[model samples]
Target: MFCYQCEQTMRSDVQDGCYTDKGVCGKTAETSDLQDILIYQVKGIAQYAQLARGLGVVDVAVDDFIQFAIFTTLTNVNFTSARFVSLVQQAAEVRNSIKDKYLAAALLKGVEAEVPMGPAQFDPAADMDNILKQESVAIVNKDHDIIGEDANGLKMLILYGMKGVCAYSHHARMLGYRQDDIDAEIERILTYLTSNPTDIEDLLNQALSAGHLNLKVMDLLDRANNETFGNQEPTQVRVTPVAGKCLLVSGHDLHDMHQILEQTKDMGINVYTHGEMLPAHAYPGLKKYPHLAGNYGGAWQDQQREFAEFPGPIVLTSNCIIEPAKNYRQRIFTTGPVGWPGVRHIEGGNYKPLIQAAKALPGFKADEEEKTITTGFGHHTVLGVADKVIDAVKSGAIKHFFMIGGCDGAKPGRNYYTELAEKTPDDTIMMTLGCNKFRFNKEEFGDIGGIPRLLDMGQCNDAFSAIKVATELANAFECGVNDLPLSLMVSWFEQKATAVLLALLAAGVKGIHLGPSLPPYLTSNLLAVLVERFDIRVNGTAEADLEKALGHAVA
Candidate 1:
């Protein structure tokens, strides 16, 4: 009953021993334990893939299997016991396959290590102490055991970062962007973790490599998105909730967002972006819908309360669907791998369930009778304004550009984003998406010339926007993206963020200041690799970090 897989971990020296009592993300010790086992098994699959590759065997089915295992362990994806159990069972099958093969090759060279079984495969499923004891005893290298709280903490960080990376790579493959180099790295690390736990330093190196690989994966995705959807440009998004009947869409799937907008159009129901859905307004095809209204709600973690306040049907297009309360359960629709046992699930590129639910729910009375939030300045739209942007910069009207965006959650310290945005000067332009942008949506960061300081790019997937904008800026200045006067201050909370981060790195963009906190999945060594190769850093503070980024102060 011990865990530390997030930016915030409970203190070890608490009087009540509260750290193990409650995980920083409100995860109970049991959930954390199970997640550890789940990862252990997934690593085994990676090892198996390595073995299969040496023998020349890699299949799409195996790819899908690996994707599912990684997705299950992602942040806020599966918080329930039932789903967790299902994931463990699937992992167990993969673990057993790897174990069986390893056993078969026991007499072969470099195959003497004892392969460990996943937790679900361990006997006495209800016994907790025995599970911990098994983990303690199964260490292949006594010299590198997670001997104490501190050691365990580092290992958890490395593992968690890998989980996020796996999730992103999985999504990119879904979009037809795949890289063999990344797959090789994933197999290599997974093999090492399951063959035998190694020294902290070695594992840390693997973690960094994972980040480096993620950069490649994300770059592929950025290309896939922009090539398919057209480059983003500066454009305005309507923020007013439509009058009579409204549908709030969330998550990172632009395909579904486009479908919903199409179905809801001219049907009297208004569609407003929510969560990652906020970026949909920037896509030409999607934003063309006059019914596409402004954004509603905040980050995923706040959905429990935010959904309750809304009176219309909500369509979750992807991940970060929290457990819903009874009051708003009927009005919420889930699509594309987002499932709540009772909530209506709309599948197969169809909007029938969502449209039907919207019809059944009490149509939302337009809340924006007066004020509205502006969004829709994605890369495509932004590039369209490239001339004006260049003119502004030449005229000394726009002095700085900050890519202040990433995922958001309900955590308290998340205010770092809000503060950073608030502190941005009038001469700076802030481009945003994901829930993190909500922090400054209500703030008054003055614009460059007539443009508002806060430019809302569409959802997390629309990180495609930032990538395109950077590429465009570099082109305008006749320099590489790394040489442009732009900075990426990202806050990650899930897999999509993983993909976006990778995309940023893959583009060879450097000196990204990421924060609120670093990811749980990166080992210290992995952090070093990222810092050395990509110069990525987690956020520190609004004023200090922002000033340094703006070249106004020493960081």
Candidate 2:
């Protein structure tokens, strides 16, 4: 029952430990066990996808299965025992269907050729460890497929990142951002999970390949976001809380965000973005509303403190919901798959519950006059300043770029992010998104050419912005992304960060320094694959890492 896959782990050290005692995140022990099992089974699906890719068999259903597995793992989505069990069973069925049909065909072909491909051995109810071990092997080098703890951690990072990507990709798909090649890779990863290879070296290679495939997925999503939604532009928003009937919107659903923005436009209900929703101000469409306000607080982990004083109802569009506090009690509305036992859920873009709750509450009174925060400097906005950026680079005005954002949590060690931001060289620019940005967003980092040293690039979902900026920087510099003087120091707290990591790998951005901690769910085989291909490393002290990043040895 151990789990610390997010930034919310209670442990002080970043050794990937978890405090499963008394249920962190309000997940019961049984539910935690079920989620572990579900993750294990999905690894099997990842094996199957990898194997199918090796066989040149591409299928769409397999892609859907991968997305569903990730979505099911998202925060605050499926806490009920029954729903968790149903998801595990559903994953098993998908694995069985893919394996049974494929195995039968291979065996029959072998028998007809007097070659007997090997005895058909496929079972869904087989030992769970065996499935996970096999899945681990599929992502590693086939010639050397044994996995260790580090490798496992790396693989989990990549897979979970892909899961996060799939969630956003799904949303973009809703907005018409579809790419068959990305879908195929998802299928390939899932199928490969079913393979039983034990070669350590080979398994490691497969892990790198997974990262490569993720690059394609990220690119597809980037195009979807920019082409469909328009590039980001600089904008500012107010942070004052709305009184009376207020609706707090959280999560990464741009569609739901837009819907709420529209529904509450004239309803006297003020809408404030929470957690991942803070980046909504970067969008041209959503920012048009005069009623849309600034971010409410930090990541989902801070809800207990941030939601305490709110006077109105809150609507969660996705994951990362903390156990409700008394102030927000009876006023929380869950949307999409996000659920809490007593909270109301609004399904399928439904706003009736949100509207009703908004009306039922006393309605919003302005907590204070609008206080503005600068945001909306995503890739597009950066590129728009392309000429100025290029000039600054040539003049040595901007020496280094640091992408210092990811999930934020309640853990004590997360303060390192804030410390690092505070210590960043004044000449360097820090780009951030996600709740992690809360650490430094309020700091007094002066601007370079009117752009704050702490630049808000949108949400974790908008890691797309980070990727786009990196790629564009490489293009502008006429060198590979690795050649740019940019460093990535991120803190991951959920599966969405998983997808962003994969995207980074896919783009061949190597030697990333990650931390606050590593995920507790990964196995060694996966980490080895990452080390071999991407040279990924965990973060150390902020001063140490910052010095290292700046090419300065200990003084």
TM-score against native, each model: 0.78, 0.82
For model 1, residues 1-555, the per-residue Cα lDDT tens digits are 444344344433432122355455545555556655666656667766666555455544555667667665565555444555566666667656655555555545444644445431343243444444444332312223435433444455445556666665665666667777777777776666553444656655555566676666556666665665555555555555556777788877676777787777788887888777765665566667888867777677788888887778887766777778888988888765556656776767788877887777787665666455666676656777789998998888888888887777766668888887777777878888677777668666666767777888756655656776788888888999877667788887655565466556656778988776665445466678679988987777778888777778522
In terms of lDDT, the poorest run of 10 residues in model 1 is: 137-146
Name model 1 segments beyond 4 Å from true.
12-31, 93-155, 173-184, 195-204, 227-230, 259-268, 288-291, 335-353, 381-395, 442-452, 464-484, 492-514, 517-541, 550-555
Clashes of each: 23, 66
Candidate 2, residues 327-434, lDDT tens digits: the string is: 676888877656676777777776877787777877545467767677888777888887887787788898889988788877767888888888888789899867
Whole-structure CA lDDT of model 1: 0.66
Off by over 4 Å in 2: 2-4, 7-23, 36-66, 88-158, 242-244, 521-537, 552-555
